[model samples]
Target chain A: MKKETLILVTNDDGITAPGIRNLIEAVRPLGKVVVVAPDSPQSGKGHAITLGSPLRLNQVDIFEGIEAWTCSGTPVDCVKLARDKILGRRPDICVSGINHGANHSINIIYSGTMSAAMEAAIEGIPSVGFSFLNYAYDADFTVPRQVAQEVTKKMLETALPPHSLFNVNIPDVPLENYKGIRVARQANAKWKEEFDERRDPHGKKYYWLTGEFSNQDFGNDTDVWALENGYTSLVPVQFDLTDYRLKEKLEKEWQFQ
Target chain B: MKKETLILVTNDDGITAPGIRNLIEAVRPLGKVVVVAPDSPQSGKGHAITLGSPLRLNQVDIFEGIEAWTCSGTPVDCVKLARDKILGRRPDICVSGINHGANHSINIIYSGTMSAAMEAAIEGIPSVGFSFLNYAYDADFTVPRQVAQEVTKKMLETALPPHSLFNVNIPDVPLENYKGIRVARQANAKWKEEFDERRDPHGKKYYWLTGEFSNQDFGNDTDVWALENGYTSLVPVQFDLTDYRLKEKLEKEWQFQ
Candidate 1:
């Protein structure tokens, strides 16, 4: 008999979030599932790892019949500990999130959800990060759950290139209005940040980060365009950040003395 | 008369670290330098931003005749806060680090030093993140300072492409043995992680993250090769994580339902 597929599930929204629970329900039938995630919310943590302190990992009885562990660290740290301590062997595939908010465009760099999946991809595990457009606690997971099932099935059957992962974002629409997935590129976009400056109770000034995401690229083949057009966007992501086109130009023309 | 160039400086190392002090010194002659950095070390913070808490920024009289501010946040947060609140304008260039350890290859993904520079690049500023192989607090800044001066001058003189940044790593060799800088790609490398599991006084188990740097790629044009061969490596990095080649193949071949 063929060995059972091992699936590692995690998220940046903490272990108890409805999103991860919905994700678990989506993929549980396809493989033997194990979960290791952060104990608390770690939304915009990016690729951060805990370096200055020891991490606490305890097995929790959260999901019925599923081995779940909670970690006191960043989303990336949970992946590291999961691989080094909990799993002790590489899983067939790793899936992170069903995150509470969208992680499209430039949000990937600030997203703990995508970073956890990216970390797994870096470790040679085929990975995918899922996000829904809704940010509410009671956001509908029906469409996201279906997307997760379809994407997860495809991933297990397909052979992805090494060190690559998928960033999948679902539009906030009813099942009837949801368009199929689109393969797209990351859009040229950014957050227009503003600091909401205010005084503390002690009269000391402090600032809260706030921003408006602005998509500057009008290309229809971009992730932002796809998401806005009521489709789920699936962008193939890579970890090698080298700008080869510019690297060649510099190598040939520029001089460093 | 030409308007003076404005340079924003920051690092993952705390505001008072010798690394940032040396960096400020290196670029002090190039332009009007403004320093905004973290109040505590945030070495592996990656691209994290402050979301859950308010940020504290305090003006400090650390460097004589130079204006500097200390922020109670990550390195990337300093860059954002610098642009929106402190500087209230875009700087000509943003430079981060003279970091006390190597941030070459896979280290870039976990580095607060590079993330700060990347944050600036995403905002249309030409930027460079510098790291030396030495991890000692008292590491010699002789060669690094000179390198910073040369690179900063070159960046100001050249018209770089938009939304790109440089990751420059120097070898720990003596100045006499230091080879000139070489433009290279990020090497395929990862950490071989090991968890140091131990029991606390309460008999509860905790784990400390420890890892050994492992380089698997043997490319002569990679950053790892340059650093090992006693040369400074300059890798131009971009924020778009999209894998275009894979996307094209998937779009043409894969069936997503």
Candidate 2:
């Protein structure tokens, strides 16, 4: 008799979202599933960790048969607390978010969903973050779930490089329309930010952060190109932020005493 | 008459923190200093932005003659708000911190100080984040200021590559003990995290995030090595998180249909 695999699941869209629920459902048959996620929506929280206050974790009956916990912290906090407090050890692999929105390119920099996966990678766990291009509350996670399962199975069967994780984004298409998966590079895409200014009832000036997607990278091998062409994009993201090419250029040209 | 160079400054320690105040004073002579920062401390907030709620900006007289505005958001929010609202136009150079603590190596991923600068880099503004090895409320900023002055002058005189910024960390040593400046790489270091799990008065378990700096990289050109040798470390950081080497490996080996 062989022991069952342990699969840890988490998301940034709070414990009540359909995305994580669907994720648990998809991965449950493959392993003993455990979920630890944020209690409230933590979109765009990035790689934030709670430092200003103590964190409280509560056992919740959200996912009927699954052992789930709600953390009163960011997505990264949930991963850290899950590793240090709940699990007491690292799992076989960690998976985060069948997220309701895209986690491609520059968006990953500000994404709590991918941040959880990055945290898992930093802790030496093979990690993958799943996201759909749709931003609606009831966005379909069906295609994303199937893709996640395939990706996760591959991750478990094979070993990834040390300190590396996957940023997987599924286009908002039906299963039949899915054009398969492509391992692509991060697109040079960004949000052209705009703030909607308005006066409060009490005459205070306030702003709402809004933006539009601007993709200038026309490279056929980039994530944006793949996703736009109806394929799911899988970018192997790393924690090292060093620009080696620029570093070399600076060392040669911009020298200082 | 030459136009006064507009310099945008911010930090994670809040608008009223001594670290940001020292930053303003140091950069004031080089430009028409504008300090748009968080109203309260936002340490370890990473690249977080407030999307669920509205943001308010208030003009403050905290820096005396220097122009400053307090934002009800994270450090990254301050930079975004400053760009969208206050600055209205991109400044010649964006500088964050004189941070009270070190943001070298992997710490930059969780640093509100460096995130603010990264936000600027994403927006095509040449940026730099300065951090001190000391993490005291009243850590001496004298040597940090001198280093910052030299760095900012070079930035103003040189043109950095697009989407690239500098992460500068100064050692907490006297000027006489300094081993000079080092154009270093980010050390492959991490925090050995320990969760101090304790029970509250109500008998509920909570966690306080604590960690020890684990420097495993023996490279003499790393930021950790430079700081340990009493040298200010300057590492050029970039926003693109793609591991090109890993991407090439995956492309050749892991061909998914």
Candidate 3:
């Protein structure tokens, strides 16, 4: 007489992405699977919730046994809809993405994949967002599945800290030659952005947002370092954006009227 | 002769809101003001950047003496636009809001006001987002203006920590009654959300998002506690979401492959 593990699954790379397909195949064996994700790709959507318009949910059959639904909303909306309308009960664990790209360091702030997991974590559900270093349309995720399953299984056995969740990024490697997992902090990395200016058909100008990932932190404890050293990086990410040490410093040092 | 300070200004309640107008008035004397803000309201926008579509910009004469441009995008877009398109050089300081509502704790994650400031901080500009607890259209600005000026003046003189910005929340008190500013940490606070299900004009069920603020942390060191105590709260917020302590703990303790 034990409670069944209700795992709420989602992704930012759309429901049709092979990443989610791989994720669904992996997690289906462990729990009652409910796949609720965006009907189309919603990468880099951040922590956006659909408040300006009506969100529509369409019941779709993407995975064979999984009760799947595609949402015309962001990845966070999928979790919201699943919590409100789709899921019969509150899910025990929420797993978002086997995203087609890396969502490490500052990228996690702008990632719809991790945002979905953050949403679940906010609701006190244990969650993790999985991403691969590869950004290809058909990236190999065979190795990441084992990493995801291992982490997901561990979280299922023991609850994660409610204030935080995992942002897991796997290095781009074939399954046979994949390195092991590494628990590390997110690297102090950033995207050095440059907007590519281009002219449209109507002779107007537009910009394509482009950026280079810059990592200055040489710490071996970072997720970036782990990935570089041939390992699946697991960064414990949190929603609390406060810098506690700086707070005390400001209080003691700054002049206040 | 001192180098002319470059100040980048933006808001969440649209470029034309009374809040931003008041903000422009306050900062006009301090430096070379460059206003780049959303043409429309972008509340609860989180950290959204315009990636899918081409961003549009329109020059405006709203702020009289200031060089201003309206962006057909989110608040973050306005900051990015200002950095890439409008600004003659990198801004020395970035100031966001005079928002009519408080963005104290968990609210910072969903605030367009703070996101704009955070975007600037990511680009290495000394930045702060000012907000008042009053959520009315014509909330009292007498208090927020003073705090904003103080914080801005201080940041202009002294550089803030890289990748860090301030989340300044003023109390909804009269200027005379205010207890002054207090550097604090973001409280462990959240909204107790309850969806009000209503019938739309088309006889379809819809939900109006409604929530009540809940402050779980009672410590005086928190932003919420400072606001409640009639002190202007200044929390140094960082964009990096990594939980470093948990990383060490997981690495040493957790059973991982």
Give the top-scoring candidate (TM-score): 1
Best-first order by DockQ: 1, 2, 3
Model 3, A38-91: lDDT tens digits are 999898788877667766677897688789998888898788778877786779
Which structure is stronger by lDDT: 1 or 2? 1
The C-alpha stretches of model 3 lying farther than 4 A from their native spots are B198-205
Worst 10 residues of 2 chain B by lDDT: B155-164
RMSD of each: 0.8, 1.4, 1.8
lDDT of each residue in B1-257, candidate 2, tens digit only: 96678899999999878888788878888988999999999999999989999899999887779888999999998998898888868898999998989999999999999999999999888999999989888888998988888899889888666766999999999888987778889988888788899999989888999988888899898999989999999899987788788888888888566
**Residue range A1-257, candidate 1, lDDT tens digits:** 98889999999999999999999999999999999999999989999999999999989998999999999999999999999998968998999998999999999999999999999999999999999999999998999999999999999998778776999999998888888999999999999999999999999999999999899999999999999989999999999999999899889988887
List of clashing residue pairs for candidate 1: none
The residue-level lDDT of candidate 2 at B33 comes to 90
Native contacts retained per candidate? 0.89, 0.83, 0.60
Off by over 4 Å in 1: none
lDDT of 3 by residue, B98-130 (tens): 897889988898888998998888888888999
Error of 3 at B78 (Å): 1.7
Q: Compose the digit string of candidate 2's lDDT tens values, residues A71-137.
A: 9999999998888878866787899998989999899999999999999898888898999899888
TM-scores, each model vs. reference: 0.99, 0.97, 0.95
